[model samples]
Target chain A: MEGNIYKKLLEELELGNKAVMITVMDDKECGEKNCNRKILYTEDNIANSCISDLNKVVYEKAKQSLETGNLEFVQVNETESYLIEPYFPEPRLIVFGGGHIAKPLVEFGARAGFLVTVIDDRPSFANTARFPGAEKVICESFDKCFDLINLNRSTFVVIVTRGHRHDMECLREVLKHDTAYVGMIGSKRRVKGAMEQLVNEGYSKKKLDKVNAPIGIEIGAVTPDEIAFSIIAQVIKYRRLADGKEEKKILSKVNWPEIDRDVLMELCEEDSLPKAIITIISTKGSVPRKAGAKMLVWSNGKVSGSIGGGCSEGEVIVKSRYLLRDREYEVHRVDMTAEVAEEEGMVCGGIMDVFLEPFWN
Target chain B: MEGNIYKKLLEELELGNKAVMITVMDDKECGEKNCNRKILYTEDNIANSCISDLNKVVYEKAKQSLETGNLEFVQVNETESYLIEPYFPEPRLIVFGGGHIAKPLVEFGARAGFLVTVIDDRPSFANTARFPGAEKVICESFDKCFDLINLNRSTFVVIVTRGHRHDMECLREVLKHDTAYVGMIGSKRRVKGAMEQLVNEGYSKKKLDKVNAPIGIEIGAVTPDEIAFSIIAQVIKYRRLADGKEEKKILSKVNWPEIDRDVLMELCEEDSLPKAIITIISTKGSVPRKAGAKMLVWSNGKVSGSIGGGCSEGEVIVKSRYLLRDREYEVHRVDMTAEVAEEEGMVCGGIMDVFLEPFWN
Candidate 1:
């Protein structure tokens, strides 16, 4: 039943639809069997409900969270609390060149959690060897490659092609897609020329003006790596800082690798090994991992994923093993408060509330 | 003879000594054989001299450059010009704990060209699997592990152990090393307590003030990765921004991966292959690679390293093939000046003076 909820949420994300995943945070008045229950709600309907009773209060909270794109821990009453998180499809980054700059750009882009795609007319430049971090590398002509890439509203386009002709071709096609960002790398003179040409070709000046010409923040970058760093920094600033004001919503919560798919898949498997799922429901101060980080602790002490990966994580694993044997849910508080931390062998001076739920298939 | 010069230079760098590598930039009055001829000059003596006639003028220039620690392209005369580059051992980043933050710290440190070493008492925490980017991972007690790591005056140390006890132990040992930078991860209260303890134990307040307590820059960082980024950014600022003023000289120049060891080792090998070495002696504006970027192109169209690696590099490769057969040197001018770049299929709006010389080894 839990697997079905996650499966439905993943499917909703895959379809470029918005969703709200509500996970019960506390056992409280609920029975041990109802502990850590979850519900997936989309715009159309309740995609999957792991909880037996989908209360009106929980449904209202999910709906409010979905509208505001907020992550909220809502306390309905003395007995119930839910962690409601709005989910959207991951943002996309499309590079129109796989040259020296593109190599580092793809690395920084992927590291920043954008699903990166590299496109170049030359196969040698547009190969996995050059851009190993890129999700897709398409060797296609510059003007005709738009059909190959998923140019959605949430996509960020960077044109760093070999010549002006290719840059113009990419810019023309990209303008029609209403991408979140369109940055073209070139000198001031080259950018001016490209803009003038596009304007003369009947493209609106206002649209052309929106492009991040000479792409990248002014960090006085000299090398390709530094330039790539500057560009990615600007991309992040745009995605995060322009939160509600921008038309393109900042989709996908959390950094890449924070959402451990392998652990989730293990949880989703049928009748798999007996394990305990540890989720950091809340955190305060300087913790290694934030709230929502999950880890899978098996019966034999083997583990997948991480909730900090230090003495704190080791403590969670120790607690999880006992919880797995008991086959119940427990909200364990991990105290790394500096004064007591040394005695407890914990480091990061923070406190975490972890929800440890025993699982079998 | 040229290979001997590079071999001796590498040896000096490996030994943590300072030296200067001077390469003749132009082939004017000097014969073709003298073009790109280099010399390795250490404090003791000239280690290797590829140029048969090392004039008094060049030696004086190298000595002056060594004193100022400057990278200079000096025009000795209308007939002779040389690019003088000082070589020092790579900066070392010693992370005291191979915990969650250390995972990203090693990566950022390595990327910033710091040779990183991670140490932890736990065998599970201190391993290659946890830190693939680190140069060394020593699994030993915090207090007893100093002998294993080379904590020289140029080393940057970060204390982030499993507890305050380990953090203090590491700090005590690290304080004796005269490291370039020392940072400790903790909350304000913990850092204050540790500092007070160290002061009571007889460490001077003047000395203790140097530590970057509460670690990282104030960027409102929360996650381990963000904190790691913040810490590494501070390290880089300490390195690149504080050049010349500090006692610990900013020694090794250029970013990591910019100096391709494979190409350099190949260049130093005895009659290994017939190839041409292309070095970007100077660049202006937004080019991919900076001055000193070297690439070796073989007769079989195989290439090692890169001088930008785009249309500009492709052009150089074609030029290198011609120069290889001719067995001569050419100071080729690559103009990617924006107006002319599009016509030539180049993108980066910069001009580069590349010294392409044929080699048989």
Candidate 2:
């Protein structure tokens, strides 16, 4: 909260350490007494209070979430519910070619919560402004970018360059990597040509089979936006539906982000800031954000991230002050199903299960 | 519209006729005088006013939308704007199993504007209450239900039955039909067993290749809802993409939906109730719905569908009444860029271009 919990989380993510953030979601009856009672569990350590009964309850669920690699909501008790949220630094889209289609693909990817990195030979094609929301924009040739980036189980390589040769080149490099998905945008004829040549060059039929050439779901999309939608849909399909068949990474213990972990590292380095990480693990009905949404609460009333900003969040903020004091990892529920929600000007009318866990490195 | 305009449209759709409905999307500046200028064009015929100068302009754009199979915003005249919207009886999700995963899949499908239909052997498994928003719930075996339904270019067939045998049975049957997608849920081992048996039994590799066995995207989904997320994502992928390559049907010239198509058809039939079909063909900035969102403006001050119901829509309704009276087909612009937009309680701070074409078929 004081420095950067996000950066610290990213650091933990780098170490390939699976993170299970447990939160208490009981907004109504629990009051502010048990507001900030949350816990964090890693493979080697537990943060906040992971020794309580809820820890035992959440541990198994967290392990399951880790195994499945999906976010879920669980009932901890009658009035209290816990969200067993697993953070997997998976589903990264690396788009080759900052073309028209890349615009929407990057935008959609970011919105769908994927870290999208775009590469292009031209500066005009690959710029921060064009892909404002994208994580990274590399203005370089496909060959250069290909050599620079890492291709692993989490990587989804998209070949949508301006020309066919570039696409073929990107495809060639991607097929050899530990990439989870490799989709190249091309006509049937063009893809056929590439495949024929690659096959002749001794690329295995199985390797060639991995590529989703003519990338996209094929809604007969014509425009860039429409085409982008198709491609993203296909990516999501591959990301979620695969049967352990794609490039999965060999994790290195204690992995961390090389850059931009400054804030979180700063927070971890500084012990004075007594903060709690509040994650919206599970939601029922209508809510602003889906599961896995997080917010950091500081004892002095500072916050980071957002679990939807409204009177509801304001209430959570107030509770964070008490929870930080109590150090109780309580499941707090937020019922925005009434006129109170309407009066609070909440867009979604649903219940939210929040877990406010005190932070510990 | 007289004597089932909805029926006529349905008839056209049945005949495999693609229709494009064009509208103007400016909600701020263009008042109701330019509201009712909408035109509907099919593969062979034109509705509303096709002979006008604007007809030529919209004709090309509409044709483009049809070819692209997507909704888009276009510039009609230098000053005028139009939205070339294609009416695709799209998002039809057909679930072969009424199992655990199918529950959330159906629910999500319905929410995502899909006409969902669930098929199961057990009566309890397939029921209206289980899938309230679904168009149909068939309480019969896969064979019985498969024989009853029409598998077309738009049908997204999902197989998530109880056991491996049921999954294989559904997959085998689905492979023969005209379906946009066919996904079956199973463990890797089970899927392998089915594949091996089907292959040994002389099922062509080409035919079996279409199935998305071990259905849904691979998000490590453990729970039913999480698993459902992956499946729905795959279905949506197939729905939006395919580029005439994936089981695009050889249309019967005139095809029709056996269920639904009530709204547009109803509008067409009520000659006494003249109306304008307003579709948000494209969008910019932050709006509630994107392109392809629609609303029906009736002469008697009634409306159907929604193009983001708020002050913005309220303004469109008022303008629609005027356009209906004037019989004008004007491409008007709506600018919600000013503080007036925020002051008027508009959630999105952007401009919309609305086409108000008089409905005279």
Candidate 3:
């Protein structure tokens, strides 16, 4: 039954659909035998849910969780709570220039888990050699690029062409589309001149104001790489924090934890039996990875993915090895406080409540 | 004589000496045929100089330029001006712990032109495979790493070890030396606890106050790559703008413009002759590169370095080709304003006064 639920999740995720996977952490008050039961919530319906009676309450919380894109533990009743993990497709970052700044921008954007696309009129600059991390590199003119890529609410656009005319052209075309982010790189005077030109071209002041001109946060970035860093930082802020009606799609994890895919697929295939799953259900302060981050520990001490790699993870893996031997399910608290560091050598800087479930069937 | 001067400059730079290269922009008011004369200022004396008559004034201005680390046009008289460009050795970035965050931090620090070194206790994590950008990677305990590397006023230390104890240990050792910047990655509570422990061990609060605890700028960086970007941005701010006595070494150009080295070496070897040297002497508004950025355009249209690449540079190259045939030295202005972009194809958004000189000897 757990394998079937995970298989449904993998299929939904593969289809580029948003999903909320709810796991009952404690079911002391629930009448149904729903403790450790997994329920998958899609946009329209629920699947593989054992707790049909609690679907109304669970649906409300899942909807809110999807809206906020937060992985958290929500109280259901007197003593029961559920871990809600929201998953969304990777955001698309379309850079409209393959210049100096665009190179690092592509690298950083891809590293931050944005599916990056580089579009430039020059074939020399817009090639796979230049942007190895970019998912697509289109050597086409600025005006012609609009027809090539899909622009939607989850798409981010950055204009960093060599000339102001090219910048304006890209801006004009990008402004017509619905995008999660739009940033153009230029000097303050250049930004003003370009904005004025757009305003003269009948672009509304309110619409043009949404463009992140002189793109990037004010970290006093002077170099091309620093500018790229600033731009991607701003992009991440919008991806994670922006909650506007127009930009409601939020992604909690930049790069999806590999273990979530690899181990879950292994569970679906009935191979790699006796694997212990460790998911961070809740985190206090300054943890490495956030809640919903998962890792799979095998019987032979091999592991996949990370929950803030270091001594704390080592301690958890040690306990998970023991859990795989005797326990079917357990809620373990990993403490990374100074007191713990002094006593048992746990080195992280926060506290995390993790759900450990062993699958041996 | 010009080749000899360039050779001397290269020698000084190779030896990692701070130098101020002064170029006379105009000699209309100055005597001694000082127009286009080159002067090199070291700490104690001047070398390869033809403007001995104006040494006192030039020396005074050169001293100020070295201290401020600014490339600017200094007026010597009513009509004559000099371009003061300062050069310093690469700053050293010593990263303790070759962990996940350390990977991107090393990449960013190295990309920002810092000589990076990564140290870790675990040999598996401390290797070239993990940190290819790092100049050196050492597999040694944090307590013993202080003896392996040199730490001075130009050194920036970043502590990102796996554990709080390691963070505290690295901090204690790092504080013993004088460094330009010191940043430690940890939670606010962990930092507070570590600082308190250091204070208990007789370290001054003022000294501890200087450390960039919870490292990186407040851009709300969540991922490791974003965190690395924020930290590198702060590092660049210190390297380019910090004006403290302890952090006096300022570097304007992150990566030494490749054209500066490759063409200067060509000049040193007398291999690239009949080359037109374009040096940005002054800038008005927002320019791609700052003053003192150079580009060498040859008679064959081959080039080295850049003065802000694109259509503006292309225009300069065309002008430089004309200059190589019929001109000795000319002061040309490349304007990237909207008015100029509308009239001509000059696409940048700023103004730069470039001194073009043909080196044909």
What's the i-RMS of each model? Answer: 5.2, 11.0, 4.9
Tell me the alpha-carbon RMSD of every candidate.
10.6, 17.5, 9.1
- For residues B180-236, what per-residue lDDT tens digits would candidate 3 score against the true structure? 789999888888888888999999887787799989766556678878877887777
Tens-digit lDDT track of model 3 for A207-246: 8877899898765566787788778877876665552224
RMSD of 1: 10.6
Which candidate ranks first by TM-score, i.e. highest? 3
DockQ of each: 0.07, 0.10, 0.19
Report clash pairs, candidate 1.
none
Cα shift from native, residue B59, model 2 (Å): 6.8
lDDT by candidate, in order shown: 0.72, 0.67, 0.75
lDDT of 2 by residue, A47-116 (tens): 4434665646666766656545556667756766666656665467899988778987887677555788
Off by over 4 Å in 1: A1-70, A76-83, A104-112, A128-132, A151-158, A164-361, B1-71, B76-83, B129-132, B151-154, B168-361
Q: What is the TM-score (0 to 1) of chain A in model 3?
A: 0.65
